[model samples]
Target: MIGLAPIFSYDDQLKRFLLEDVGSGDVTTRSVFSYEARHRKASAKIIAESDGVFCGGPFGSRILSYSDPMAKFEAIPDGQPYAKGECLVAMEGALESLLLCERVILNLLKHLSGISSLTASYVEMVRLLRKSSRSLRITGTRKT
Candidate 1:
């Protein structure tokens, strides 16, 4: 879909994010997994830390794939409501690869969820207020 095309197109941005967080390879993960670790498979689930809207499923998938092409990922559909501790992403791949991409994927999920959650709250608040006055609406101001 067009939604996913943008993610793949922004190679520099994704690489920058990884480079900023993980530089010259992840020493910690590398130390734990040896060169032969690519054959090892590991599975992990991303759990929500707080209640919010799930808004980064696709982003998470893309980030993981970018970090490790062999990493298998499954993320919940975006723009849906989720409760705290809900599983947002399920990934199974090489242990080292999973560890390397974990932080970036989680960070993206957290950021997107925060924005969607706030927007959802504001919409709910407006809905409640709108019930009292159907004529009241949120509108953009334009100057002629």
Candidate 2:
């Protein structure tokens, strides 16, 4: 809940990201999964590979929703701390939809969580170094 941008703000970018990954359709998934198989429901979880300040669950949910409206996405609340092997996001939906969106979702979560973890470490370091100054602020540049 840390000042997340409006979901609309990401519409174009999200479309572009999905398009980039799913260009010309997911031929492999389409070829491999029969109509009945594609419709079969399945569950998946994105598990943390290391401890960090977790981020991007909401975004991942949004991505899944975009890919398949019927899909259910449950995300660990953003900005929370999670340990290695913890579930960061849980999704239930058609197996085909899950397969299609998996890589993109994982890539996004990894990038965002890395930033969140690094920023948390910096903040913690500052907090420990200056216990008296309550006004010290940590800011970042526009560079990503």
Candidate 3:
């Protein structure tokens, strides 16, 4: 299987997304639990919603693991094609831990999957246009 190397970056896209979603801050998580809160281990499964060439499973797992070290993930091999509604990866860890990492993991997956679907759509459109063009031809007509 082709291994599309994962990109581990600390950049603005993610930081901004977190800032927007977290709002003033994650007051809920912080208020309910201490700054160093810990919780029971839990599991989460990431699944694809549509059919397309699968990518970024490893990237996603890495992002999740980085967000929460205690979180463990098992993802299908990189560049492994998967079908619609396929389980891309399984995450196991503390509820708090998983929650903390959820957005980053999803962001990575979303970016990769969105690009895959868009490329597929563009390819299909090109194929259809090619077929249509092949059906037409220029013909010579006698001048009256």
Candidate 4:
């Protein structure tokens, strides 16, 4: 079977890679923009493109919080059903902070959500198959 790319030597390295990708600072966002004078909340809507058992809602929420401590996070609990185009989580926060954190948030969402989707697909396929009958019954009848 084909293997996933960049197979880490250590299991914990995946989170390190993600943090490294984000870097110590987002230089562009920091240099180019100024914080707005008045406080305002920004809502980030996480919409699922396809049906999947939603598995990473909390991680996605934590991504936002990690990006900006002041962010207000609300998410449908993890391991719940999420239909296509449904909102999984929402964050209300400062516009500049939200923009700075959007990519990281999406990355987490994409990765864990994909895992959930693939697992669900495998489960559904197994559920539809007559595995015991196909293997055991076929073997017994053939022997007779």
Candidate 5:
């Protein structure tokens, strides 16, 4: 099984992305949430709007951890199949922290999941077609 080790290997890249998205600080979250409110506990979940092969669960957990070390993040394993309306990730943390990382997390999840889902569909097609040709195979390239 693919584990968190592979996800941790991308820490540097993920940090760069978080830094780019959260340059200086999150002005909106800071302004909208008073000091007390910022620390108020909140819980949220990312629900799938469509069926797809879920990806980035570990990365999502890592992103949330960066925002608030005490935050709790739980998600289905990456590469798991999900259905529309299913919860992909569930997290609880300070309101400010959650809001700060929400966009970055959502964007990553959507982008990665889309690619995984599409690739799964292509592989399924190949599997169906391969019955007629024993030598046929489907492989991925690093070009993307």
Candidate 6:
């Protein structure tokens, strides 16, 4: 079925993210680029600075939408593995909007992908051990 990326209900929280990150204004951006920057179209790839499994696609999409309604971001879907320097997220939109959301989106992707990669490693280890011990089972306990 075809469906648009549903605008998550956590828009307020997302707005807070923008506010916290931007504050009064993007001083560096303002000082660095001309007012013409806002009118320019731009594109970027969120490359994997290190090898990992990708995660946080939905959240990254939300951040893009929250930053600019017309902006678009794409990743190879969550839980997919990507090699170092591979494009994890691709975005295109107004130059200003793209730059504005860049760091936050990358930070979320990196953090979530890091966890996913770590979990994959653990799964691989457990599977290897389980081959020799059929009764072995992975168990997890959580505070929540």
- Candidate closest to the true structure, highest TM-score: 5
lDDT of 3 by residue, 27-122 (tens): 667678754554767799888777766567766665555456767888877655677788988999877667776776777777887787666666
3 or 6, which is superior by TM-score? 6
Question: In every candidate, how many clashes are there?
Answer: 0, 0, 0, 0, 0, 0
lDDT of 1 by residue, 9-78 (tens): 5667767787788887788877766778844888999888888898877767777787678888888888
lDDT of 2 by residue, 18-69 (tens): 7799876678989988989988999999888899988888778888887789
Roughly what TM-score does model 1 have, to 2 decimal places? Answer: 0.83
Per-residue CA lDDT of candidate 6, range 1-144, in tens?
267765565677666777788776667877888989864889999877888898998887888786688887778988888898888888888887887888878777788888989999988888998889866666788757
Top-lDDT structure, candidate number: 5
How do the candidates rank by TM-score, highest first? Answer: 5, 2, 6, 1, 4, 3
Candidate 5 lDDT at 131 equals 83
lDDT, candidate 4, 1-144, per-residue tens: 267666554224434644676667667766676655223576777787878777666665555666567888777776677888988777888766677667766777678778877777766666566564442211124454
Instruction: List the candidate 3 regions with Cα displacement exceeding 4 Å.
Output: 1-25, 31-38, 120-144
What's the TM-score of each model vs. the native? Answer: 0.83, 0.86, 0.60, 0.68, 0.88, 0.84
- Extract clashing residue pairs from model 2: none
Candidate 5 CA-lDDT value: 0.90
User: TM-score: which is higher, 3 or 4?
Assistant: 4
Scored by CA lDDT, what does every candidate get?
A: 0.81, 0.86, 0.69, 0.67, 0.90, 0.81
Give the worst 10-residue stretch by lDDT in candidate 5. Answer: 1-10
What is the per-residue lDDT of model 5 for residues 68-110, given as tens digits with 9 covering 90 to 100? 9999999998889999999999999999889888888999999
Residue 126 lDDT (model 6): 83
Model 1 clashing residue pairs (backbone):
none
- Model 5 residue pairs with clashes: none
